[model samples]
Target: MKFDFHSHILPGIDDGAKDIEESVKLLDDMAADGVDLVVATPHFYCMNMRIDRYLRHRNAAYEKLRPYLKPEHPRIILGGEILFDHSLVGNDKLPYLTMQNTDFLLLEMPYAKLDDQIIRGVEAIVEDRQVKVIIAHIERYLAFTSYKSLCELMNLDVLGQINAESLAHFGTRRNCFKLIEDGYVHIMGTDMHRIERGYASLGKGMDIIRKKFGNDILEEFERNGKMVLKNYSYEQIVG
Candidate 1:
């Protein structure tokens, strides 16, 4: 079964799917595309969301949409697309968003260059031995002239996540393929947002995977997704 580990399917929170109707529609589309499970990863920017409030709203939204969920639709799981913040690392308030009880945390980086502070922040989290960090959408960090810096980060035991859409881009596809080939990337996610832009792009991404990598590669990607659902450690799967 296919699983989309990242999506903004949670309703009325942040920019994704303004209401339940849109959220349900996104689910239907995912189900039709063979996604058996989807993580309702709403944005969890530290600047905006308080931990208790985020959980309360997430639960309420899940409850409101429960009755409408079809048996054939993808199973919804709660998570958040957490933006990186230094305060989040030992803070008891934010641990719930870390891949559902597993040590792995989905960490989003800033769109620009990777700074020393970001590196140290991630190092602090890893050094604590409490969380194994997964750098969400590693492709965005390709602006660096040499991939040595990226390689250095990967050696820290941080897993990389690649967005499906990058596989189809001319400029980015080569690097994505290179990362996949080198085994640096351990997970694939849609990172889907709106139905119009996100859903359509995901479809194209699936096609790109199918055409370029064949079914076996796609199957392996799906297997990693299942591994996440089962809370498997990255060391167990990647090593």
Candidate 2:
């Protein structure tokens, strides 16, 4: 199935859709784009709020948009774009923060220097929390460190997610392709914040990959997406 691995479609919970109307529009557009499902990953900061309060706010936002979710629209899967923090290590709530019914946590690294300490913190979360960590929008951190550091981080069994919009420009597109060729990218996300900002780049980005790398390359991405949302078969997910 075509899965949008990351999104901020939840209403009023974070800096995403303002309310139910905007959320519906985002879902409908994603449906038109041939996206079968989308993970509604509003940002979750462990250091900023209590886990109970965050989940409560997140669930309530989902409920607000529930009535507008039609069968034709992309199905929503609850998840979070969690900021990595030392406090999250060994926290009992980490599992609850994973993608719904899956072990993958969409982890967003801090914008600071990408050092061994940060990498080790990520490693601890994996070894201790027992959840697969999907590094969110891996392309955004290019200025923070070198690809070698990222490859090293990848070696610890964490998957890397890239924003589909990263392929918008020539320089960025080459970097994206390099990541793909090097086998560093694990999944793609729209990172859709609002209609004004636009999220349609997902289809364009996939088309670029298909044109440059062929159908097999696109299929490889779909394959990884299937692996993440494996609880449901492709036949079972599509309406």
- TM-score each candidate: 0.89, 0.93
Q: Which lDDT values do the candidates have, in the order given?
A: 0.75, 0.83
Per-residue accuracy of model 1 over 133-153 as CA lDDT, tens digit each: 778878768875347667766
List candidate 1 stretches off by more than 4 Å: 143-146, 201-204
Range of the 10 consecutive residues with the lowest summed lDDT in candidate 1:
198-207
Candidate 2, after superposition: displacement of residue 205 in Å?
A: 1.0
TM-score of 1: 0.89
**CA displacement after TM-score superposition, residue 130 of candidate 2 (Å):** 1.9
